[model samples]
Target chain A: MTAGGHTLQLFEQRFGALRRARRTESIMLFVILVLLFAVSAVWTDFSPTQILAGLPRIGEYFEKLFSIQPGRDTPPVAVLSWAHVLGGIKEPQSIAYWFYRLDVYAALLWQTVQMAILATVLGYSTAFALSFSAARTLTANRTVVFLTRRLLEVLRTIPQVVLAFIFVWPFGIGPLAGILAIAIHTTGALGKLFSELNENADLRPVEGIKSAGGSWLAQMRYGVVPQMLPGFLSYGLLRFEINVRSSTIIGFVGAGGVGQELKRVIGFNIYEEVSAICILILLIVIAIDLLSARLRHRLIGAL
Target chain B: MSASVTRHLPKIPLERRTLHWGIGAGAFAYFVYLLWLFDFDRIFTGLPKLWVIVRLMIDWTLFAEWDHAELIHSMAETVAMAFLGTFLATVLALPLGFMGARNIVPSPVFRFMTRRLFDGCRGLDQFIWALVFVRAVGLGPIAGILAIMVAETGILAKLFAEAIENIDTKQVDGIRSTGAGRLAELRFGVVPQILPVMISQALYSIESNSREATILGLVGAGGIGLRLSERIQINAWDQVAYVIVLILITVAAIDSLSKWLRLRLIGGPAARG
Candidate 1:
């Protein structure tokens, strides 16, 4: 064959091989994924039959949640009406009756919010202090940076609920346990994020401070803290939103919050009360999310 | 000289300084109130108990005596639930994502409703969903998996929809110019562009879901959380410490594995970004 013909043939051969390789690689990945799914499905006992069997029960549970049960004198109701929803607590089908313990729930919800706020503030402060030490660019001592990073990592790696479970023992089953758990977890998470912000901060200011014979603390405060303060606050606000959700549930371990009430109602199978509390939690979470998002937007805008 | 320096200095605003002090004092007051409300005195009283638990955990004398098989199995179950949940959610989210994407659907009302549905699904925490499912499904890894699936479907769908909306329209146009149909255009143009993002997001979810799955068992969803809680209930501090360490290792392992897979599949600094 002519040299030109040979070159063309070789190019085609190489292209075909490349395509074949790509196809095989994708096929291999697909097979591996399928195998993994099969194994996980078996291990988790995820059966379609089970889901199908449970579907009606799930429907019934939800139906029960929407309808109010008959009181000692009231007749059984099949469905809720607008009138019933807006009716007095004496009306068995009324939402007010469904949420008869509103005052208790409200107080617990408030405590949940307070826990979130306190945890956020405490965590933010602690993380802010540790972040400088954790940041390689800010900390001159490598050992300090390494140790601080590891400490933060360990703090965050354990789930907050598990931390709360442990804390319940120490703190005796109250919001204090929950708050401390959330605070420590937040500290770890925020510390890592803050250190990253510190690492990315403008080094010129730090250099200027150092050249002026400033100490490490002075350099960090004058140089890095101001630059990253907005980011820190933004993250802190976001964390508060997350902590609200966490604190709401941290009571599952008896670490004070509305979650404890939720777990109780759930345990006792008080379907209407369960739905009411869930709705309340949802509203609070959404409200906090909106507020925090607005705050963060304004903060970023100002900066 | 002092008078000259004073004259050269800029005048600070009085109200601004007062505002700063006011905010500071108000925050401090709130903090103090919260401290009192949460019963700050408990810390001192709790110190001894905390120390004892801490010491017991660190002792490690009976570490090998603990139930290794059961703990390891529970840990594996947590990982499996996370993987299965994330996998199923990713599968379900793809279609929902297309429906939710503005460019794909072209109907504002439908997209609005879909977005709201996503919001509703996301509004509840995974733990709460786990509790609900535990009640529904009667407590097992299935409950945990379903909970993760429901919660992650919402999150992944939202991310996928955003990814779909952000796709390069020129590619779709190019495919359409080649006499390709709508489905063909999507297959050739859209899917290719968004697959990497979807995979990355799914992998990220898996990492987080593993952490979450560990706790789902607390609500009777089945995982290491059940074991940990059981141990805690029995005051088995040594066993609890073992379970916690195992969880930390498993989570860290999964995190790195997912990171590596993302890097391998995406193939660049873009993966890290």
Candidate 2:
């Protein structure tokens, strides 16, 4: 065979073989994934039959959650205007009408945000202190490192809700219990993140400080903390975002906040009140997210 | 001499550090005040009870005769709930991700609306979603899964869309040069570019959802949570401790596994952590 022809033929053969191999690999992967999902579905009792039966109930629930609408049989207003679109504040169909308890909602929202702020501030500070030892490159005493890390892990592993549940016993059912619960959980979480940042820190400064006979505290304050502060603060901010959401949930178990109120409204089947409280909570969370994002950007820029 | 002095004298002099120290001191004082106001007396009185609770939680001897099979089952259920919810979230998010991507959808209105919808979904905390789902589905892992699925979908879509928008559009142009249809171009180009990110995001979601799901049981949405709550309520400290142990192990294992996979697939260690 001509050399050109032989090279072309070889290229085709190799390309075909590669394509076939890829196809088989993908097919096998697909099969395995399908099998896994199937088994998981069965275990979770998420069968199609169950979903179909449950879906309408979900629709009904949402129907109640949505602000009251004009009855299907109600006659159309003769005129359309912006004012008409906004159901009257006292009108049952208006969103504002549903949330008429705005003062109560606002107070609860403020309390919830306070809980998150306090918890995050306290937690991140503790995390900042603990992270030095938690960093593998920094700690001189292995025992201290081991103990600190284990402590953080245990703090993180237990749910904040559970901790709050326990704390309620000592502090009584109030924001204090909620704050402590979230703070402990935050310490574990932020410590891990902070330590990772510490681990990744530029060590030259630390080594420089050490060679000059710097004290352990001096090494951290001058050498490690500066490099990691921005990252730590960023993570702390993110944790605050998460804690804000969690503090809302912890309230349901009598830890105190808007969530306690939310739990009450939900239990009584007062769907409109639930919707109002929910809307308020949603707005607070979004505001926090936007504010935090802006703050992080500015902080990083400054650093 | 300057460098030596720098090392000898900490970077910030004591006088200069006063402001920083003051902030810290103020925070500490505020915390103490809060604690004091919150019935600090109760804590001192409660210390004895706290020790008993801690001892109960730490003592494995009490867990020896606990129902091992049930504990194992609930642990499995927790993992399964995380897995199932994450899977559904990823599946539900993928299409919306495409719609939300500004590069993909040229219409600003559509893109804006899609993003707003995502923000709205994430704004409501997952606990509320769980409560809503429990009401809807009548209490089970299915409700937990659905709640997680709904709650995560918007956030995942937002992440996925951002990843899509950042990809090198040159690849899509290269695929287009071959006379491929839009769908084919996207299939051959966009999907591959986004696959690594999508997988990592999904895996990360499952890890986080696992933590969140552990508590969904508190809302009766299904997981080991209901059992945990039950144990806590009934003062079955041993069982509660055992369940807590199981959760810690599972969470740590999954976390390491996901990190490893992300590192392997993405070709980088967690340097940014």
Candidate number of the best DockQ: 1
Model 2 per-residue lDDT tens digits across residues B1-273: 778866886477677699889999997897777566555567676678767887877877755677788767877888888888889899999999999998899999999999999987788877789998887778899988888998899889999999999989999999999999989977887988898889889989989999989989999998899989988888777677788888889999999988986786566542211
Each model's TM-score for chain A is 0.91, 0.89
Predicted model with the maximum TM-score: 1
DockQ of each: 0.80, 0.58
Question: Residue-wise lDDT of candidate 1 within B128-165, one digit each (tens)?
Answer: 99999988878899889999999999999999999999
Task: Return the top candidate by lDDT.
Answer: 1
Please report how far candidate 1 places residue B62 from its true position, in Å. 1.6
> What lDDT, from 0 to 1, does candidate 1 have?
0.91
CAPRI docking class of candidate 2: medium
Give the alpha-carbon lDDT of every model. 0.91, 0.84
lDDT per residue (tens digit) for residues A165-211 in model 1: 88888788899999999999999999999999999999999999899
Cα lDDT, model 2, residue A31:
97
Interface RMSD of each: 0.8, 1.9
